[model samples]
Target: MIYADNAATTKISDKAFEKMLPFLQEQYGNASSQYSLGIKAKRAVEQARKQVAEAIGAQPAEITFTSGGSEANNWVLQGVTKLFKGEDIHIITSSIEHHSVLNVCRALETENIKVTYLQVNKNGLVLVDDVISAVKPNTKFVSIMLANNEIGTIQPIAEIGKYLHGKGILFHTDAVQAVGHIPVDINKLHVDFLSASAHKFNGAKGTGFLYKSASVDLPNLVFGGKQEHGYRAGTENVAGIVAAGYAIEENVKEMRKTAERLQAMVQTTVSEIRERIPDVWINGNAELRLPGTVNLGFNGVSGESLMNILDLKGVCVSTSSACNSGNDEPSHVLLALGVSEEQAKSAIRISYGKYNTIEEAEYVASAICDAYSKIKSAI
Candidate 1:
């Protein structure tokens, strides 16, 4: 099968799996326990923490393990708001953010926190100028995704970070889709908080981390035993955490080469598909997108229908975020980019991974074109 839905989730790498296996077997011990077995688990978790921190150019103390990106996003958004309770604080976030961030903002609004849902351009980019203009004196925080999950457009984070730095507003980025795929540095991004998921980068699922700048302080999202340095409290997912570290380390080592290869495959597929389907248009700034990800709008076609047809042919793709898989609503991300509902509904995302080959890319292009032609003829 040609799996083009890396944006949704990736298959766990062999190396990561290998690193995780022992913890699930004989190494089963709670990280918080005081015994030698537990001490070993604790050491493993700490080593994972360091690996994650090093990957993002953060201090080990800054990384807090979480269930996944959603939790990390929730903690940062809600936890930070708790710090300024009863104050007129505003948050600036782009409308194209994953529902994790957008929904949390909505929840905050019920508590009377002001949130400015910043608009993006047609290319799905959050302009730094728009962010600057939206900031109020009461704007205490800004939450934006480093890269969009649907269109894979990288945001102008560094520039926005530079501006927010001068204003002393705390910034958080949901870097779930960007971390292992591209270079990420806490210092470079100048973010106070960052969220990432291991599954997006070929590590085990149900494992992720949050990077909290040493200078920032936020309330606890979970209340339980002392875990995550009293910031996030719960028993750690030892095996998943170990895998995450090894997977991230391995991916970073081979990132440049893998990205180059995937980009070539993506280009080949897009070119071939577009050659046969003239109305096909990419949804974001094509030049500034993730290396192997593309959201294509096929005029006069139902994205769901195309996705189902592709599935039947063993070419896996997605109509939108996997989180909203069953929801019939038009994509919020596309709507935020000013796309008509009809156009938004007609989009499909293709995300290639390091495992995909050029041959599979060519096959997927032919399959898509053939399916499109068949669907068009039926009309």
Candidate 2:
């Protein structure tokens, strides 16, 4: 099968898998134990932490491992609410954030926390000016995603981060789709917290980390024995952590070449599909998005129908975020971009990965074009 939905999840890399084997078997020791085997596990976790920190230009002390991006995101958003118990708090976030961020903000609203859901332009970009305009005296924090999962639009986190930093308002970014696929520097983004996941970047699933700047302090979400610098509690997934470290390091080393190749494949796919279907148009910013992701609006065609057609042809694609796939509602991100529900229902995302070849790109494109034609003709 030609897999084109890397944005949802990526196949684990060989390097990461190889490094993780020993930890799952012979090196199976609780990182908290003081014995030699436990100490060895603990050291491996620390090494992984350092690797993750170095990749993102952060201090080792700032990284906190979690179950995945969702947990990391929840930790920061919910944890920050504790810092201002009695006082009124306001948060500013884009309307296009992952459900993890949006849902948490919604829950906080019940507790009288004010939230501003900033609107994105037609291209799925949150203007820095809009962020500034939305700020108020009670604005305690802001959470914006670095790259969108469905459309892959990279936000102006650095610009927004700079403004928030000057105002002393806490800033956090959900970088689950951006981290490993692109360059991320905490110091450069000026964000107090960042979230990432292993599965999105070719590591084992169920492992991820949150980057909290050492200058900032927040309460713990999980309570138990100390595991992550006493900030998070639980028995660490040593194998997954080890795999994530090696996966990210290896991806970074070959990032330049990988990006170039994926970009070329993206261009080829888009051009091929457009050649066959002239009315088809891209849904997000053509150039400012991630190298490997493109959300295409198929006009009158139903995205779910097209997706199923492609799947039957041995090609995989997605109509929206994997988390929201089964829901009958149209995409919230596309709706935020001013797209009508009809248009939003016709959009499908094609995301590439390093392992995909030029041949696979062409095949996927052909499959999409063929699927689109068949679906359109039936109507």
Every candidate's CA RMSD: 0.8, 0.7
TM-score of each: 0.99, 0.99
Global lDDT of each model? 0.93, 0.94
Candidate 1 pairs with clashing backbones: none
Where is the poorest 10-residue window by lDDT in model 2? 220-229
Model 2 residue 207 distance off true place after TM-score fit, in angstroms: 0.5
User: What clash count goes with each model?
Assistant: 0, 0
TM-score of candidate 1 versus the correct structure, residues matched by position: 0.99
Model 1: worst 10 consecutive residues (lDDT sum): 216-225
Tens-digit lDDT string for candidate 2 (1-379): 8899999999999999999999999999999999999999999999999999999999999999999999999999999999988998999999999999999999999999999999999999999999999999999999999999999999999999999999999999999999998999998999999999999999999999999999989998788888898888899999999999999998888888999999999999999998989888888899999989999998889999999999999998999999998999999999998989999999999999989999999999899999888987898
Superposition-based RMSD of candidate 2 using all C-alpha atoms, in angstroms: 0.7
